[model samples]
Target: MPETVFEVDVDAAPEEQPDPIVNRWHPDVPPVERVSPGEKFRVECLDWTGNQVNNDDSASDIRDMRLDPNHHLSGPIAVDGAKPGDLLVVDILDLGPFPDNEWGFTGIFELDNGGGFLTDHFPNARKAIWDFDGVYTSSRHVPDVRFAGLSHPGILGTAPSHDLLERWNERERDLIERGPDDETAVNHETHDDDPPLALPPEPNEVLLGDMDDEAVEEAAEKAARTIPPRENAGNCDIKNLSRGSRVYLPVFVEGANLVTGDLHFSQGDGEITFCGAIEMAGYVDLKVDVIENGMERFGVDHAIFKPGNVEPQFSEYVVFEGYSVDEDGTQHYKNANVGMRRACLDAIDYLTNFGYTPEQAYIILSTVPVESRIAGIVDLPNTCVTVSVPEAVFDFDVDPDSLAEISSEGRGRAARPS
Candidate 1:
């Protein structure tokens, strides 16, 4: 346990934490603490939604979730002497659930609110409560599934410079405000069933740590929303950023104000369900160093990482494939979004055959360490995507011809909003 720089009780609201967390990214958001290069520190975080969602049967909390003020982050902890043109070297030394609170959640947010990758097929809010036992997690809401947690902070990075922040705002505003036309036809991979095109900053529920009201007044509206991954690596949800991972985050400001939160107990790649990971309020043990002039030295414009050694040990999988085509069978050319969506739908349909409900399967795919790979993105007229699940997660043999299966006769929809 490194020195706990930021601590919080998950039951407490974000603003009430020992070191109040920030929900949006801004260069001016004052750092709550400062650390020298190579210092090891611990940061406690609220769940991504700041305890808004809960551990219960009904998903009414998820359904009524407010979109703004998400991903409440633990710091803008300034790294001493880190400056623009340098790289912030970060090592994810350790991560895990709080011992007393070892349960976490995965949910499909309502289509009208933070819609997921497969929102069209499963539109309403739904949830799965996964309880951790050692490193493995199993959910009461989904059946015949258990796997080791691939825990990681779903989002984290160095703060963007004022200029970089402006660039982010301009880019998002452009995307959110853009209408269909010739340029869109050539460039946009937009789809009706895809995640939101862009998320612009919302000041309505902005949380900017312990910064005074006067500074908050000026920076709130300009702070970048935490919903999308930009150059700063804000919301990548990369599952492999677990223990021992080292990521080089681009520094665009003096002191490299580092922020991290949205801890996950486990997550499949793509995090297809939007709020899909087994999100928990937990702590991250980090050791950070400065790489002066390394951004240019490495030609790095975005956060780059190498995965750590902690991973699920499932060696075999039941693989499902999908191509770039709509549910209506309309043709698409090299569209990974359409292909991935179809692959998820394929997996959902397969599980329903073994007696798991579609909603249950949906949550399984979201929370477990399943592999969602873009098999072929440049395959001419159609892109190919694949979703592969570990054979061992289920209690029964996955081979269709060999084993008995759970009966769908009495099964019902997974947890839904009241």
Candidate 2:
């Protein structure tokens, strides 16, 4: 018998729902429920796109989708005994697809508006409908490839303290003020293209009773958008954080207002492209416990989590290599954004060899699970990145047996070193 303390329903009507789905994580956002430490609870999360998208949505729909308040998060569940400088231990006990219908989607954004890795190669928008059957998911758009589900919450963290929020705002504002000309400014823009700047809270919106109008306004303006991961671990999108994983987060505000959303049925490392992984609406069971003064004991400030029971499938890979150094001898290795783009283009080129057009290849890459790795970074002038696509993902024969093994010996034989 689990000591369940709170429950949230993502599909409920606005008036009927117990907890409000917030677009941002702020300490001022009133918690939907309160629970003592060591209590268990369940959260029902809407898809990353906030249920605005559906299986019937077309590529055009994705292209025209609004970017504000992108991921709808489910909580800020206050822990009774938690406080700043403490640690919150979230034990992920179970994660599964929606009970009514087990379905999800993978999407690729248009290149003009903050595109993904292969933006130049794949400028158009696309989508793949996924059907989750137990532990596996298959997409109708990309047939013959079924991947094991590694469901996990894409966004999970505690609300930042007033000071931390100010620091984040200052740092990001500085980068934005630096303009896009600076090499470091390319992917450092803090907020998404269109933030809900003018959108005020709904009339029925619930807020913390203790806050006044000035405090509410401050919170609304200063709340960090859920785009990038921070010290508190919001929007980390680590796919391995599935059932059985234990996540430790540094507490910032009183009661450690924990929030969670952006459930993904599956995702590859780096989530290379935009619009993100197999976005899904699902139920997550978590056991919340507090570790008093654990941050000082552990000597860490950021979030850390152990891998879940789910393991990535190992198969023969058709590897593609990319370099950050261009023909002009200019190096862009300092920023990973450049390396990701190069690797994506390399992957697109390789996919074209197998009878896939640039568009089709890009869609396949976005929908499929392809591992991206930083192969090397120490080699001064140039940094190396590699994208590994499993040979097993293709139903047709790619002749993996004829390809060189992914080892030094295979490369040595090809070079014929005496």
Per-prediction TM-score: 0.93, 0.84
Q: Give candidate 1's error at residue 225 in angstroms.
A: 0.4
Write model 2 residue lDDT over 1-418, tens digit each, in one string: 3543334455664224455666665677777778877778787777776665767737666777766656677777889899899999999988877778689877677776546655545566777778888888877666556767678899999989879877887777775555454354333343454222222222223333234657666666666777778888999988789889999999999989888888888877677557658888877888889998989989998998898766667677877776765324456645555666667776766555555555555655554667777888788645677877777766665455544433433222111000
Q: For this target, which candidate reaches the highest lDDT against the unseen true structure?
A: 1
- Candidate 1 residue-wise lDDT, 1-418, digit = tens: 5999888887787777778789888888888999999899998888888888877888889889977878788898999999999989999999888889899988888878888877778889888888899998887777667788899999988888889889988877787677443222323455665555677777788888878898888788788888888888879999999999999999988899999989999999899888989999888999999988998999989999989998879888888888877677777677777777888888888777666778888888888789988898676888898999888888666665543544545334333323
Candidate 2 lDDT (Cα, whole model)?
0.70
Stretches of model 1 off by over 4 angstroms after superposition = 180-196, 403-418
For candidate 2, what's the RMSD? 7.4
Deviation of model 2 at 211, angstroms: 8.3
Task: List per-prediction Cα lDDT, in the order shown.
Answer: 0.83, 0.70
Evaluated at residue 291, the lDDT of candidate 1 is: 89
Give the worst 10-residue stretch by lDDT in candidate 2: 409-418
